[model samples]
Target: MKKSLPAIAPGLPLGLLLGLSTAAPRAFAQEAAAPALEAAASLNAGDTAWMLTSTMLVILMVIPGLALFYGGLVRSKNMLSVLAQVFTIFALITVLWAIYGFSLTFGGTGLFYGGFDKLFLAGITPDTLSATLGTIPEYVFVAFQSTFAAITVALIVGAFAERMKFSAVMIFSVLWFTLSYIPMAHMVWGGGLLAEDGALDFAGGTVVHINAAVAGLVGAIMVGKRIGFGKEAMPPHSLTLTMVGASLLWVGWFGFNAGSAGAANGIAGLAFINTILATGAATVAWLVAEGLHKGKASMLGAASGAVAGLVTITPAAGLVGPMGSIAMGVIAGPLCLWGVSGLKRLLKADDVCDVFGIHGVGGILGAILTGVFCAASLGGVEPEGFSMAAQVWVQCKSVLITVVWCAVASFLCFKVADLLVGLRVSEEDERRGLDIAVHGERAYVS
Candidate 1:
């Protein structure tokens, strides 16, 4: 039999075999490249317009909406400081996002950090399609995410309002946004650890709300109580303005939640309805709880409840059905009230605007409940292999990761700002208010 076998050609060398394996795919890829490019070129105009509008709405949230909301909550003496901080943070974060923030958050495929391949947006052209939402141009996605980054930083200003130096605020924002926000965004949205773990954060309960809340709490504690721990009146100067600001926030949130669907389609419409239902339900629940606790519900309670509802629904807007959204709102209203009252006292941090109380507590609740609600048994569009217990665990892990990272990074940022420019204004400046001392102008003249 051995003698009868025919002679055989020698097998190709190992290097040749490896090269053939790799080069064959590369050749096929080159052949198919034109079709991929053509597919990417077929951009949807409607999606582009919606994303652009969403970006504008989120910008409005930070500027007059958040600014006026926080401004009304502080004493009239410090009103200008709150407004100035919000406006300036928006401008600064926007610039940073264009330069390096977007690239670092969305460029690479690393677990904890992203690469600088798109540094200074060097490779992005008008024709380039987004990696995530391919129907829109990459530029529109950049602009949309920029607004989110701006609002996240702006939200933190509420916690340390009325006392920190403007210089300190500026410095702390840069550091925290760079260290805390970028990494969190990567983990949740940029194909990092959290995203890889199958953690579901539809619209950033962990990234936006919890991250900002923890940072705010840390800053408040580090800056110390605002001169008079528990002794002063410290009432909101204008609930009228507060109501208007809250109203603006509610309107703009439609874009914030629904627009996260990245298309002008059924999911976006569903998110829109959920946002409305949840916000309205939260408002009612807040009033009811207030009546039970204090015997009379104030307009302020309604406004705060609405905002809390908005926060609670942020993670679930596109994930859960209408009933689940309402349930979240109802749960969040009373829970957040307790957070502002009981948890606030327990922590003893001077979170001036209750940033941690409402946003933080509501965000956590929404995130965890989102996992439970997004089940086939609960009316959500569940996946084939969805497990409620598994998803809930993943959400908890995501929340824990965000809290620890933000807490530690923000503490370091505050320390650095303290070393560089100092954190708190003088006691005299605190009494006079940052509006006068820092800006050389008063919010209201007698």
Candidate 2:
């Protein structure tokens, strides 16, 4: 004659009251558990290892990879200067990123910039997890993201190479990194405005390539052409070195594109394969375009094509399939060739290394095409409630925003650096070569 109840849902004399008193507290306790507990539950060794490896690869891309690539493109007099600029920029940004850069980039809940709550990594610890990748320690995420800031700033050096003062380069990079790179990182990757609007940047098309390209273009214009630029031949000092540097960049980009997935999962694998396919296709497409246009496919064209493909595939790596990535590469090759050649002539900026031509045009192209290829109909990872047209609009919006922000910020930063320390070397020093005049060393001992 006792009231019967389900075994799992024990019918207490006061069912609602007892449930609130006992079950509610337990649920609250679970929700309020410490980060250490969460880490124990979800810390993934495989993902952590992969991210660490990726971090190293990206660092390699900056030091020897970018350094040598830019170095080989300049006259021998400026070779060492290129190395010095790239190395110093990398070192400086790494320090700044540790100080307040990480905090202002990913700490706060703001539309444009992050808060300074994590200044000098204030409260972060070995057990702290990143908001985006909960499985990895927050420190790993900081290191990984910091490398991105370094490479992006380093990319600007190529535009004004052989003319700018080393001091000016240092000052400008600090200002731009603090102002431009940090804000863009926050907006796209740090849960800020662009992210809120559902803009996609898998590995930094808008953030890295496009942002740097715009900044470089501005710097090239503001700094003025190298001495005797129009009249001088300005041939690359060493194509052999350029080829070697390009090879390193190609190898290191696997980490750049694939590592963006934030996990050692299927998406990472997809990014990896797509990077390989897209780069190869771009190489072929570039050579074909050059062969038809110039009557020969040179090593420079091949190297340029490879980089174009890499840039085009960066933002869409994980979102699209291999074939889609190949399509992007094929399109980017010729377009970027024109960017460095015809468009370079039109812009009339020195662009010592074609930063605008390759990175700028390729990034805009890739970012837009990502919208097309990310549709499930094109063998992409399907987004929930996806519309191709809507997504393309969002992509274009992101690109436009990045272009405007970077252009203005770069122009301002260059002007500031010019005010602080002269932006250019003395004409005499420039003619003498930065290696001996500025740094008192030579790339070649001759």
lDDT string for model 2 (266-332, tens) is: 7778889999999999999999999999999999999999999999998888778788999999999
Q: Which residue pairs does candidate 2 place in steric collision?
A: none
The per-candidate count of clashes, in order, stands at 0, 0
lDDT per prediction? 0.82, 0.83
Error of 1 at 23 (Å): 34
Candidate 1 segments whose C-alpha is farther than 4 A from its true place: 1-41
**Model 2 lowest lDDT segment of ten:** 12-21
Model 1 per-residue lDDT tens digits across residues 1-446: 11100010011111111111111222332342334434544578987888888778887787799999999999998999999999999999999999999989988878877889888888899998776566788899889889889999999999999999999999999999999999998878776778667666767798899999999999999998898869978899999989989989988888788778776766677778999999999999999999999999999899999999999998778778888888889998999988889999999999999999999999999989988886756766453346788888878998899999999999999999999999999999999888889999988777
TM-score of each candidate?
Answer: 0.91, 0.91
In terms of TM-score, how similar is model 2 to the real structure? 0.91
| Regions of candidate 2 where Cα sits further than 4 Å from its true position | 1-41
Report residue 249 deviation for candidate 1 (angstroms): 0.8
